[model samples]
Target: MRNYQPATLKKNVRLASKFAYWLDCELSEMTSANVEDYLIHLHQQGRSAKTIKNHRSAIKVFCDFLGTRGILQDNPVLRVPSMELPEEIPIFLTDEEVDKLMVIARLDDMFCEVTLALNTGLRMEEMRRLEWRDIDLKFKQLTVRKSKSKRPRTVPLNQRTCKALETQRERYGHLVYVFPGGKGGFYNRGIWTEPKMRSENWWQKLSIRHIQEVIPSLKNLPAGRTGRGWHDLRHTF
Candidate 1:
């Protein structure tokens, strides 16, 4: 934890913590059968096969790291059977629902973030790491240095994003994060969850969580639960 970067370490440890829980044993006790059961638990929990695959990848990397340190006999993940996932087309939201969200937009800061995600397709981590200097106001562009693939991409801002940004200037500032925390500025890393298709802090954080509660019209939309994770809003675009 002390050696690795914070976010990377957090992800590694989170996987380890779950592995411990699933196997009812610590990292030292992890074995081939235990790893297999973990995958089984994921299936029982209704996690998509793709999600299971990603979780396995994370667990495998951590297990391999443990092997190098002489903690495990070998990476048990390598012993687990390869999982087969279904081939499903991507699901996206209609433009009408997107417009409905805007009509009900109350949090100016969230509006900017949602607007940017809709127009530019920036992921949560990318948007969180974004500093004021990264936004190129003159060029009407937002640049993310490293996204999911660890590749930097630049996205052009449409008239809508500009208007959303402009509307946010008073609520935030040139240096303040476009998405500020309750008191002000970037969220303290303590208890923040990724904004799923639902909304930021939808599952926690009472104040911001209520944004969805207040906007009842959106609850009736089909994309509401199917792709409730906030990234679907980006996926929809």
Candidate 2:
């Protein structure tokens, strides 16, 4: 569907599979009570409310598809309540931290990624989907076509960002993606696959693990916190 990205579609498929594995009866026999029970099971297993909510959403979509196909007369997940997440303050890098990070990134050959993220505030997914054709160096702007909000937006590039991008272009300009994967494909090839089964090229994405390794201070922070990942660069911007 136009509303679902490839990665998102794969995730939903995986979640649906997991749900089917957990259920005792056939999927056609599933009911709203079974869906509620599964949610309770997730909660009992110490799954976060957000995680359970995602499970619910995925299962809901699957049930809807089955309904459309006449495989089921009713959708099970419709009766489930939406998960309410607690509000938390976002954390960002300090000026001193940013300077240090940039210095290290330059040394690590990630200067372009770090600079572009900080300056343009693009999400990791947006950056991963970025193409050379999306940028206009002469105009000092880039367009985000695959944003989470599903709306294209133009981001103005600063001098630092432009310089970093120029360096990247010189090295990988002929490639389709600005930050191509190891085989000159999109970054994080097979990213939707199970981690243990993924190819070596899976490491090509500018992931949070890479960021944490570069900035050791981030590694010590609590998991699931805002400042621990690459998004902090966007926040810093």
Candidate 3:
């Protein structure tokens, strides 16, 4: 935990915690079967391939580290079958699709968020929590303080990103969060959930409806229960 970045440490810690609960036994009692079962459990939960891969990596790293310290007889992860993942290639929108997406994003009042994702390749979670201070428009850069790798990174902003961010500053810079929902509150991460999708006035629903209308194939894109909206924008970048 001390060696890992914040996000990586959190993921590893969560993996340990969940594995402990699932095994209901000491570290020495863990076995390859237990690891396999945990992977199956994650699959059953509708976790994406990337998410399950992360979990597997966390568990493998944890077990290997402990095993070297004489805390266990074997690394169970090594004995478990490797996860069969689909192709690593991500779906991306072409220039025409992007132009259409941007038009719809504007109509749906999500232009800033959509544009930021396309320019920065930020994850949905990262974008949801971004603040005004994170962007340094003068330098044409934005800092991702809380990244999946635990290490912070500053992404360079292009002319399009800078322009969009400048516009966003005029609209939302006074607030603490760039995308506030309630009084001085950040947007809920579950805004794209099935329940929220049913809302007649939710911004996500409006944006999604328009985007799918423009790119009908997106409606059939395979995503888990959480669905993939702006994530494809990141890929498009």
**Each candidate: what lDDT?**
0.62, 0.74, 0.71
Residue 37's lDDT in candidate 2: 92
Candidate 3 TM-score, true structure as reference: 0.63
Which candidate ranks first by lDDT, i.e. highest?
2
lDDT tens digits, residue span 93-128, model 2: 887778877776655556787789889999777887
Candidate 2 Cα misplacement greater than 4 A, ranges: 183-210, 213-217, 220-228
Question: Candidates ranked by lDDT, best first?
Answer: 2, 3, 1
Which residue pairs clash within candidate 3? none
lDDT of 3 at 157: 91
**Per-residue lDDT tens digits of candidate 1, residues 131-229?**
555677678987777676667788888888877777665445544455544432124322222222223333123222333544453343333332244
Better of 1 and 2 by lDDT: 2
Better of 2 and 3 by lDDT: 2
Better of 1 and 3 by TM-score: 1
